[model samples]
Target: MKQLLEILGFIALVQGVAGLVHEFTDWDWGFVQRLDVLDGYEVYASVALLVLGCALLAAAESRASR
Candidate 1:
């Protein structure tokens, strides 16, 4: 279970970083098509993902230390 969370956290972190880059470079990837629903809020959504990813990563680490 912990491993799964860690994997998800990593994905989220990568996606968030990618989103930030996309915002500047406008380099569209196939996966980003799924986010069309975000409309004009992609940047904010990316930030939210980043925060959630960080939280999940922290949770995973905390669990590991226990």
Candidate 2:
């Protein structure tokens, strides 16, 4: 379970970072930019992903220490 969380967190973190980078630099990457539903809300979604990633990582760490 902890491993799963960690993996998910890592993926989220990568995607979030990629999204932000793409927004700022027009790097042409990340799944955020490919979503039609998000449209003008890519930044917000990216930020949410970033936060979710952190939370998942923290949860994984706490689980590990148990």
Candidate 2 residue lDDT tens string, 1-66: 999999999999999999999999999999999999999999999999999999999999999999
Give the per-residue lDDT of model 1 (tens digit) for 1-66: 689889999888888878877888887742332576887888887887899889999999988998
User: Candidate 2: where is the Cα deviation over 4 Å?
Assistant: none
Residue 45 alpha-carbon offset, candidate 2, angstroms: 0.4
TM-score for each model: 0.87, 0.97
Residue 45 lDDT in candidate 1? 78
In model 1, where do residues sit more than 4 Å from their true spots?
30-33
Residue-level error in angstroms, candidate 2, position 14: 0.5
lDDT of 1 at 2: 82
On the 0 to 100 scale, the lDDT of residue 4 in model 2 is 100
